[model samples]
Target: MMKMKRIALSALLSLGLTACGPMEESEPMPESMFEEQGSQALDAACTSLGTGITSHACVHSGNPADHLARTASATRVTSAPSISTKHTAYDIALPSGAEGSVTYVPATTGSYAFYRTQNVPFTVINGSTSATVPSALSQTVSSSGCLLVYVSVHDLTAGTTYIVATGPASGNAITVVPEFLDDSRTRYYRDADGDGYGSTTSIYTACTPPAGYTTQRFDCNDTVGSGASINPGATEVCGNGIDDNCDGSQC
Candidate 1:
């Protein structure tokens, strides 16, 4: 009686992706590279991921002697932290390809391992590599040095962003996109002149947010203005900034 799953965002609305905040702290992965630290037993590059992930943790704070510098804005992160969700323009990004069969379970059997940052342990793939666990699928199984994986693959291609290692401890594993789209097919992202992140526009064009501007999230750098930069096939803009994260013109 453990059949409960519904963390549906449609694996991020079928790739018309969203969410341009959070997950942008960068530079924090050294605790002697972690073989096992104290706060828990997990590491981070990204982990503990499951239920097809969308709520995983650990970006820094891997506990490098608890180094926060103890003052002065902690160095940097002033404004742009209120991230829970928001990034539209169909979040188009497909080419983080290559993944298959990854099944590992060793809760009480000891000596279980995992691999892959980008293939080559046999051309990379764990497709159907199960270790016989059908106690009705076993709550995904994870404990102590936490680890739980299950992948059977099937068209199962959604958005993309994966890099999880577990053995000496590592992190990052975000999943979803079981199919969901709309926003003229859901995809949105914009930063224009801010350049902290989110740079990519054009989802059917028409953008203009630079005149006087009361509040600016971003506007008309090109959405279909055909200004040439939104990438893909080029030549298409009504003005929402079509550079679509190609980092050219959308502001």
Candidate 2:
């Protein structure tokens, strides 16, 4: 459907250029200040992403993680599959030049991110019937000296082989590292009292743990300031009628 629309638009543009009369000066409009500010904020966000394969930043995430790991950074170069396939509905239509497709079978089902070392358009096709558009794609980040730079996020299913299509590449070799974003997030519990221990009732999941949160859990009394002195590590006061050590009994 999308490919047909693009073809029609190209034909219309070609005809207009050939039949054009006297052309007038068309001054380009200035970019909105608000849009520029938003772009700067996005750039700042990319810089703050941590250093690792787990980071969501536009920069390369080294090699793929867990079962998805293929090889070291230098040796992961893979040949792009020819655009020709039995399923032409999911084909990527480029104005000129041949495109490529690669079969990607994820190890686990989750929100996966794909990073391309080259500055080419990348798409993930779920099956012959449907193709997924990236939910999150980098806008400000650019490639840095042969390193993977551009990135996009898509929901992938484990065991289901999908087609990863890319526009005509420079050298016909493209390295697209796919990482499971869900695996990167660690469970964190809220530590409101600033104590080393945390309450399981209040928990968070994120790659980067949020402020006032910790990995430690099982705080019997997480009641703000007073709870600071009440944790699993605290000594049990026998007659105080409180389970100071969180042992489920006071004695």
Candidate 3:
């Protein structure tokens, strides 16, 4: 019986089969392993984002509109700070140097993040109104001599225009990616004019509304002097030649 068992084991080994079970399939190689040898995660000159399957990267001339076009169309953009307008005064304080601006419009209202390969100062502003949009938080880390700077911005409204400025640093072209962040916080819009209603265009996200903001939106005219009465809760002062109630008609 022992001799017969040994013969059976030898037969299995000769057939390239394990005693416990048949041979298992080899695992597939990871996507990163397929990259060329010695290639850094992000190239030294520029960073490519979402560079797999359907997405691609491209160079953006220092035009804000072009930046908006490429990014909105799902193409990643690599751009350099404008030498001419780097010192242009933005809504927020910037480092003393050149900077470039990109116009971005979110597809949905939520939190979003901006990731850059180069460590440089960045800011977001309301494009239509030129108001400084505060960021929720920001961080910077090192990666193979590249600086990964990311800024988290909350309550970006869909269809509203926003501006992203990068700069005050010199080097090769830098890659910038705007990614949407998912969370459960409530969204609020700015009500600077003290109107009970807010502008749907300018939004913010938080556990509670920050100072000078409100949960209500859709104030057709939220400007000061007459905006205090222009809200959804106001009674229509019919035929006064103004849509005080924001119902799209004076009467």
Best prediction by TM-score: 2
Model 2, C-alpha of 88: deviation from truth (Å): 28
Question: 11-90, model 1: which lDDT tens digit per residue?
Answer: 56655545544455564444344323221211121122222121121111122332222111111122211111212111
Candidate 2, residues 56-170, lDDT tens digits: the string is 3223334233112121111111233332221111122332445556566666555555655567866677654555645443432343443555666666666666766676666
Find the 10 residues in a row with the least total lDDT in model 1: 176-185
Arranged by lDDT with the best first, the candidates are 2, 3, 1
Clashing pairs in 2: none
All-Cα superposition RMSD per candidate: 23.8, 22.1, 23.6
The model with the greatest lDDT is 2
Question: Per-residue error at 44 for model 3, in Å?
Answer: 35
lDDT of 1 at 142: 28
Stretches of candidate 3 exceeding 4 Å from the true structure: 1-97, 142-147, 183-251
| Candidate 3, position 10, lDDT | 90
lDDT tens per residue, model 3, 178-239: 55533222345678788767875443222234567777888887887778888878899877
Q: What lDDT does model 3 reach? A: 0.50
**Model 3 / residue 212 / CA error / Å:** 36
